[model samples]
Target: MSVLEIKDLHVSVETDQGTKQILRGVDLIINEGEIHAIMGPNGSGKSTLAYTIAGHPKYHVDSGSILLDGAEVLTMTVDERARAGLFLAMQYPVEIPGVTVTNFLRTAKTAIDGEAPAIRTWIKDVRESMVKLRMDKSFAERNVNEGFSGGEKKRNEILQLELLKPKFAVLDETDSGLDVDALKIVSEGVNRAKENTGLGLLLITHYTRILRYIKPDFVHVFVDGRIAEQGGPELADRLEDEGYDRFLTETPVG
Candidate 1:
């Protein structure tokens, strides 16, 4: 079984004031086909963990290791991590000014697979994924995320997830900026990808709305840059009702 393990991870970033720590010894394991939801308040380091796993240059790992199938992910470059079947769906996807969506997706798929996809099959897959995400065919010709709405950008992210078929995906606040219909559409896309690939997921979010569509096998409460509590889906329901107030009260922010 494929496994992604985070062991005593400590990450820091340079700010205007100076170096400030974000993750403080976060340890977790995600097995293949498992969905792990990380619910936390703002500044709780959920996004930091996602970026660090994807090997973002901005977040420096002071100590600890991220292992993918026993391979050290911390040492791998960003693209290397993707090639190794690790994917990150950014909260705020950036715009690629000149690259068309078709070209960008194909390029990324080629990079990860180490070969150009067969044009016939690749075109079919992309079109099908777009249709599944409720995206129109015209999006294929548009520049990547350029002039796209928030919902459109999110669907684009999921489109990549479905096409790339990574072993694991860290969705950093993917539910943000989505309306009810858009949320359901995006969540369905994520679920479809997981079903097709058996990809493990680390879903990070503050609200529990997304959890209704994409059920999590395990729910973790992140507070003060660490997992304060964890449980089954019932925990998410509890948090929905009680909110993060209890966690915020118990755990002081760093």
Candidate 2:
């Protein structure tokens, strides 16, 4: 069983205001096949934790370790992390103007597997995943996220997830800007990835709508740059009903 452990992680970023600390002493563990939802208010550091784990150069790791099945993730480069079975789906997927979707997916698959996929089977897999996500056939030829609708970009992220088959995926607010149907389709893609590959998930979101479909095995309430509370699916239901009002009391934003 693969285990992704975050031990007292502290992260910071250099802002125009100068150095700013984001994640403060965050800790969690995600075993393969577990879906862990991280819910928090705006500016509560949900995205910080996701980007930190992915080793984004912008986010500085002040201290602590990110371990994946006994390997030190903090020591790995961004691509090394991906090759090691770590994936991050950004909130705003950037447009790669010169890169077609098919080319991008194939390149990523090859990079992660350390060898190119067989052409015939790889094309078939991409098409199947796109069909499952309700993407148009022409989407395979379009530049990645270039002029795509919000829902389309989000669906494409899931398409990559399904194709890449990472051991753990960190989705940063995938539900944002998606309509109900789009949200359901994206969630289905995520569930399919989990069922097919036992993909552990670190889903970061402000709202609980996605949880209704993805059904997190554990729900963590993030407040003041840390996990203030944790529970099962029931915790998400409570957050949906009550909102983050209770947790807002302790946030001393300067």
Which parts of model 1 have CA positions greater than 4 angstroms off? Answer: 251-254
| Candidate 1 structure quality by residue, lDDT tens digits, 1-254 | 99999999899999999999999989899999999999988998999999999988999999999999999998898899999999999999999999999999999999999999999999999999999999999999999999999999999999999999999999999999999999999999999999899999999999999999999999999998899999999999999999888887786332
The per-model lDDT (C-alpha) reads 0.95, 0.93
Q: Residue 181 deviation, candidate 2, in Å?
A: 0.6
lDDT per residue for candidate 2 within 88-161, as digits (tens), equals 99999999999999999999999999899999999999989999999999999999999999999999999999
Best by lDDT: 1
Cα RMSD to native, each candidate? 1.6, 2.1
